[model samples]
Each structure stands twice: as structure tokens, then as C-alpha cells.
Target chain A: MEGNLNALTVVFTEFYYWITVVVMFLIHVGFCMYEVGVSRRRNHMHTLMKNTMVIPLVTVTFYLFGWWIYFGFQGGPGITGGIGDAPFAEPWSALMATHLSGPSPDLGVSGDEAALWSRLNGVFWAAFLLFSWTTASIVSGAVIERIRSGAFWMLAVVIGSFAWIIDAAWGWSSQGWMVKLLGYHDAYASGVVHGIAGGFALGVLIVLGPRLGKFRADGTPRDIPPHNRWLVTIGLFLIYTGFWGFYAACNIPIISPEGIAGQITGETWTATNIYLAPTTLSAITFNFIMSLSGGMMAAYVVSKGDAFWTYSGGLAGIISASAGNDLYHPIQALIIAAVVVVVIYKLHYWVERRFKIDDAVGAVAVHGYAGSLGVIIAGFMLWGQPSSPYEGFATINPLGNFLGAVIMFGLLGFLPGYICARILNAFGILRIPRKVELEGLDFEGDETYNASVAEVIAAEKAMV
Target chain B: MSTNGLTSWAVDLKDVGAIYPFQGTETVLVIILLVFWIGWHVLQTRAETREFEHDLAADKSGDEQRKAIDRY
Candidate 1:
């Protein structure tokens, strides 16, 4: 009977993650379409391809090392302890490949670990890989027309596989040093993924320089609107759909107190966040809709029904309240989302005018600034609450989350991006040549497409 | 003679684990996959650079640019 129950639990958990991976694929689709809508017709193909390729580029590299880093570096490699053992996540571990969950001492994983992790490994890896792709794609939309695809792909790999995973290990993991020491908590990666990626895009943009003709001699900014307004709104809607899956993937579907090994005193089975703290899908569901409503309402009033900002406000709202959605009252999530969205919108324009940083789609404000603020707000809202069920862990606090936001957006996000962009610029491989930018990134491809269309039309005319 | 080492289904399910062929070759498979992944990026970058150079050479006339803008 015990064997049957264990098998049932494992299978159910496996299926749960598989479903989440399928839903998360829409986030990539939405990102690709949104970028294409934002870019000009002349640069459409390049914009689409740049975002599309992040899927494969990040996936392969994440498989190579990113998964291992999450479990391996939880101790900060020195903060809490030495590099931890994560045999199941090793690229060459048999558990990472096809397995029936049977004993195989030849594999790096022990028999016990294999029994638990083998079925869950692939789906778990894929779910995190989708998040990595999201982080990389956030940077893609900000540097559309002028950046080289090769340089961008390289940057994507660094963020998707290296930088974001390191932050996750530090803050998102149950045993992460940040959670253990400072009581850092971001249930849905408001800072770990969005904040870091947003900051990284800002760093790259500063060094890559704004799009040509983006600023005038007087230093006032011009509004470069999306070519397909409808497409942009539709893409935002699709992103909202995928974000639902993202929230689900952040949980352990079902586990008992015995499994958690923490301070909770009950035999009850429950879902938990990545930090092994109690939460429920029902609580987050209520929070997601209310927060989204608050953001859209605030943005409609602020932007005066501007389609792009209004839709983006919905996303920024969700991101802003994401950190504490796991625990906040629905009304708290709504107010937080409303306040953060308004601030991010105002800050977006202020930064653009103040610094002449031409962010094509407000990625920095929506993701970086909003995400960082969300982490800080979660700290204050949940202050003195237990960060984890584990004994002796720090309780959630304002100071810890604020420092966490800085580390995510500055240390891990902006620093690497700035250094990388500077190096790529020095090597003269960062941006497209000026003539190429003016003529458009897809000049030759467009010409070919044009010639083919004319020939097809002429042939059809003859048939008439 | 079965490829998966599974000739019968009468055995207890608890004894089953890895049923795939080449079970012990995970290390070699990973090395091969790693090389392919890196090699793809190298080849792809070269192709992309050449394509960009071609686009720069072919677009001296701004006719295509005007048509694209007008279409928009």
C-alpha cells in the first residue's frame, strides 16, 4: 500500500510540471510576437528571429550547467557551507536522462534520491528552462533594431543560464543562504528573474547606445510606436496566460510535514513555494486577477487609455505584486499592484527624458524597476513572518529584501551586462553598422521576399 | 533479445528503473551533445555575419525601404 501511494504521488507531481511546461511555451510565443509588433516592418524578420532563437540557445546551455548551479551553490559556495552535492542535476547523471526510477548505482545519484527525483527531473528542468528563456527574451525586446543577433544570443546565454540561476540559488531555493540568513523571499521570482533581466537590459542599452535618430539635438525623446497596435495587445494577453503557468511551476504540488522536515506540526499534505513555505493555488488565483485589475485601472487613468502602456501596465502590475501574492490578502495585492504600476510608468518616462536611454518597449521599467520594488514591498508586507518552515531561519524583513533587490538588479544583472556590452563594443561586434541600421536589419531578405511576391503576382495575372 | 531488456511484463514493477537502451552511456552522450551545441553557435554566428554583410552591400538603393514604410 505504501509503495502504491508513493508511486501515485510521484506520477501526479510529474504530470503537474509537464502541464506547466506546455503552458509556459506561450510566454515565448507572446514575446516573439510582441517584439515583431514593436519593430518596424523593415526589421520584422530580425526581431522575430532574435527572440525565437533564445528558446534553443538558453535551453541547451541551461541543460549544460544552469540546473546544477541551482542546487550546487545554495550555500553561496561559502556563506552557509561549501558547494552542495546535486548529483541528480549533473548533466551526465542518469537521472537526468530516461529512467524508470529504478536503482542504478552507476549513475551519480544514490538509490534513494533516484527514487524521488528521477521522474520529476526532466519536467522540473524544463519548467526552469522556460523561465530562463523568459529572462533572456526580456532583454531582446529592448535592443531590437541595432544589436547584432550573435552578440545578443551570447548575452542571452549568459543571463538565461548563468546570472539568473545564480540569483535563484542565492534567493529562490529553500536552502539558499539569503533565505537562511536574511529571510529573503520572492515566491514567484519578481526580482530573481524579472528584476535581474530588466537591469541587464538597461546596462546593455546604456553601452549599446540608443537607436539611431531616437534623440534630437534638444535632447527630447520621440515616441516610436508599435507598428501593429492590435498585435501588441494580443501578445500581452498571451503573456498573461503563460504567467499563470509560471505561478504554478513555482510550487511543490503536494507534500506532507514529514517531507518538509520543518517546523510545521501536522500530517497534512499541502503545496509549497520554492522555499518550502505553505501557500495555495487558490490564494494566488485570487491575487492574480485582483492585482491585474488594479494595474489596468491605474494605467488607463495614467496613460489616458494608451493601448501599449495600458497592456504593459497589466504585466507590470502582476510583476509588482508577484513577490507576496503567495501570502497577501487579495486587496493588498490589488493596492500594491496599482501603486507599483503608476510608479513604474512615471519612472519609465522620467528615465528616458533624464538620461536619453531609449528603451524601445519599456522593458526596464516594467520588469527591472517594478520587480525590484515588488521584492522590497514583499519584505515590508511580510515582515517578522517566518521566511521558511525550517528552524532558525530569519524572518522576512525590509532590510533583507531591499538588499536582495540590489544584489539581483545591480550585482548580478547590470554589472555583467555592462561589462559584456563594453567588451562587445570594443571588439566592434555589438551593434550593426550605421548604414545597416538605416537600411534596416533585414534589407536583403525583404528584397528577396518582394521579388518573389512580384513574380507570383505576375504569374497569376497571366493565368487570369 | 529485447532492446529494452524487457522481455516480460510479469515481474514486479518495483524492480524496474532504467529501461532505455545504452543506459550506461550517459557520460558519452552528454559530451557529444555539448560539442554539438557549441559547434552550432559557432556556425550560426558566421552565417549571420555573412548575411548582414550581404544586406549592407545590396541596399544602396532606398527603394525597398520606402516600399516597406509605405506598406506599413
Candidate 2:
């Protein structure tokens, strides 16, 4: 609407985010497939539905309050002041609907703000919404089979719409207190998305307990093999593809120095992390592939070429190195990923045995432990580096990021998750009864289907 | 003149901002949508609980449950 340069930038940025939202949809699809694949044949339909419902449920609730939480609570509310203004993200804003980017004085949006947000807001909100679905779906995998659909959906809304979004506000946002005070530097949400979701899943798993027969009378854990290996492999592959979109969504694709209005003073236009610090697509691409390769190779050797663990290790690799991927040398990313996978793989089994907790899909280790480690690793790797381009922000340090990781994985993630799951459990809704668990979640549906088939066959025989 | 406040397309496009119909009633629309969303969870939760309770009442025999496990 203004200069040609401005128009192009706005359109391109808007389209860029829109594309990422589309691609990130694959993450949810992958989750459904992966959960169903891991579940028994008897529980297949129920498992798939459990993950699939996360999409719609999280979407509406996210539209309601999640997006607003991201902008409004960046101050810690308690840290800087109180809940701040975020006119563009408010659910009732005119900009929240279809708009052409002109003046909206009656609606309290200025022409300048409207023009920018009009093109960007929907796509940005959608991209974050997809991340919300991913967060809830991550928990869905670890709690399949025994978790009541009703209870899981309620928990999904909590994490997808409330808990994870709050962590995003506190750590992932540019003006978050974790960044300004603690020098947190999770450029790609190793801690914000993956870490918190993982911890939340762990907390829930502790309360919900394992699937029936997940343990033996002797207290030894059993390895429940996936019902379908092909689906599991394909699901993991799709997640890898969607993760590219997640990484892209984490960046401000292109911005000029003045756009950032921070310490960065240059004529060069560049991509930046969520914190408005400069990075490049090239840097992340190199690290993403390298770390993934490192994770797979290490996991294959460590788990003795177990396909499930190998694929998960590759994901853990990307997540473990994601915090510093923007600045990491590819080899550094690879080495970090390789080492972290071994530790997490062992920790997964250790936690399983020691705590008698059964994680159906190892989500707690792959996402939670790997993600927290990544955030802490970034502080050391990028020590003394500016956490944000903004003046007066704290420099990146180990202590700051360690505390940030704790806030992400423990304070925000585990506490809310444990409390919510406990509430649901106390109400006798968290886990399905032992009778239902043994009979299969789809028992009634399967029985009805069998009866229908028999009746149709009898009718067909009479016609013949 | 229109629900979207557009009488014509004859004017400069730059003057147009919100093009959605019933723009001023966004707050009301949001309120209605919020109620619908929360209502959905309530209904869904009740339905699911009912299904589970019905399944529990139907009460498959021990042998049938064993057979179901074997299907896995």
C-alpha cells in the first residue's frame, strides 16, 4: 500500500508464514500415525482419535486466549509490571478478522499497525496454533491406550491453550522476562515448545500411571513393541519434514536494522531468531541436518539399531542442538546431538526402571530432557553473547539459561501438568478403568461392527 | 452502506480497512464463539463418559476380554 519495497516485504513475509502453517500441519498428522502405530490393534482407532482431536480442540481454544497470552504476558506481568497491551492479538480486535490494512479508528487500531498486522496476524497466529497442536500431540503419544479420551482432551486444552502458551510468553517472546533478566537464548524453542511439552507429558504420566500390563509382577518394565513399524517410521519422517516448518516459523524471515530497533546497526536486511537477533536459514539448515545425522548414527549404535529409538534419536538430536543451531558450527551441533542422545537414551530407561513409570513413546526423554539440555548447552556455547539485540538486556550465560531451562521444564511445564492430571485423576477421569483397559478402548465399536458384518453377510447369502 | 461499510469499490483501495461483514460486532461474535467452544468441551466430555459407562455396563466376559488381548 505504500512503497514497492514495503509492499513486497509485507506480502512476502505474510506468505512465508502462511506456507509454514500449512507445512506444520504434518506434525499433527505424524503424531496421530505414530500414536496409533505404537498402540495395540485393539486400541488403534481410539489412539488415532485421541491425537487427531488435539487439532480442533487446541485450535479453537488457542484462537480464544492462547495467542493473546503470548503478547500480553511477556513482562512476566509480575516482573516488568502487569498484563501489557496487545491490541493486535486480542480475540475481539477487528484485525483478528479479515481486514485490508487501512484505518480502523472505531476499533482502536491505527493505520500503521493495521497495515502491518492485517497481513501478518492470521498467519502468525496460525503458525503458533500449529505449534500448540504439536505440544498437545506430544503428550498424546505418551498417554495413549489407558487415558480416557475425555480426560486427555481436557488436559490437551490446558497444555495446548494455556500452559505451553504461557511458557512461550515467558521465554520465547522477544520481550520475555527470561530473556531480559535471565539472558535466555532458545532461538528455536528447544526449551519453550519441546521442553515444556515433554515435562508436561512426564508429569501426567506420573499421575496417570502406565498402560495395563506395561509392567510385570516383579516390577520390571516391559518393552511394548509397536503394532506397526511402517506407520511408526513414516510418522517420524513426516515429523522431520514439519520440523523444518517449525524452525522457519521461529525466525523473522527478513527484517532490517531499523525494524528491530536494537543494537544491530546495519544496512543489511537479514533473518532473525524470535529474539530479534540475527541468524540465517543457511546456518540452521546446516545444523539441522548435521545434528539429525549425528543423533541417528549415535542412537543406532547405542540402541543396537532399534528403528524406533533411532528415529526418535534423530529428533532428539535436532532438539538438543536447536538452542544454539543459529550460531553453532555444524560439527558442534552434530557432536552435541550425538552426545546428548546417548545420555537421554540411557536416562529414559533409567527413569523407567527407577520410577516404575511407563512412557509409551519415550516422549519425556526425546523432547523433555533433550530440550532442557539444549537450552543449558546454548548458554555455554554462546556465552557472553547478546541474548537480544535490545540494549540493556542480559548477556547469555550458563546460570541464566539453566534457570530458564528449569522454569521451562519444571516450574511451568511439570507443575501445571502434575496439578491438572492430579485433578483429573481425583475425579476418576484421568485413566480408563482396568476393565476397559483390558477389553480394549474400541471394544464396543468393534462388537457393533462385527454384528453389522454378520447381518449383512446373512442377507447377501439369502439373495444368492 | 454495506455490512462491511463498503458502498462501492470506486474509491481508492487504500481507504478500506476491515472488509468483513458486521465488523463492529466482533466482540459479540467472539463472545458467542467462546460459549460455543466451551459448550463443546462440556458436551463432548459428557458423551465420552456416557460411552465409557455404557461399555462398562455391557460387561464383556473374562474369556472375551482374553480373546481381545490375543487379537493384539
Residue by residue across A1-464, what tens digits does model 1's lDDT show?
13787888888999999999999999988998899999998899999999999999999999999999999999999999899899889998888899876765576666656777888999999999999999999999999999999999999999999999999999999899999999897998899999999999999999998998988889998888889988988898899899999999999998877778776664677788899877788878888887887787667667756888888989999899888888776666777887899999999999999999989989999999999999999988777767788888887889999999999999999999999999999999999999999999999999999999999999999999
lDDT of 2: 0.86
Error of 1 at A144 (Å): 0.7
Please give me the total number of clashing residue pairs in predicted model 2: 0
Off by over 4 Å in 1: A460-464, B1-72
The clash tally of candidate 1 reads 2
- Quote the lDDT for A351 in model 1: 97
Candidate 2 segments whose C-alpha is farther than 4 A from its true place: B1-72
RMSD over all Cα atoms, model 2: 16.9
Least accurate 10 contiguous residues by lDDT in model 1 chain A = A103-112
- Candidate achieving the largest lDDT: 1
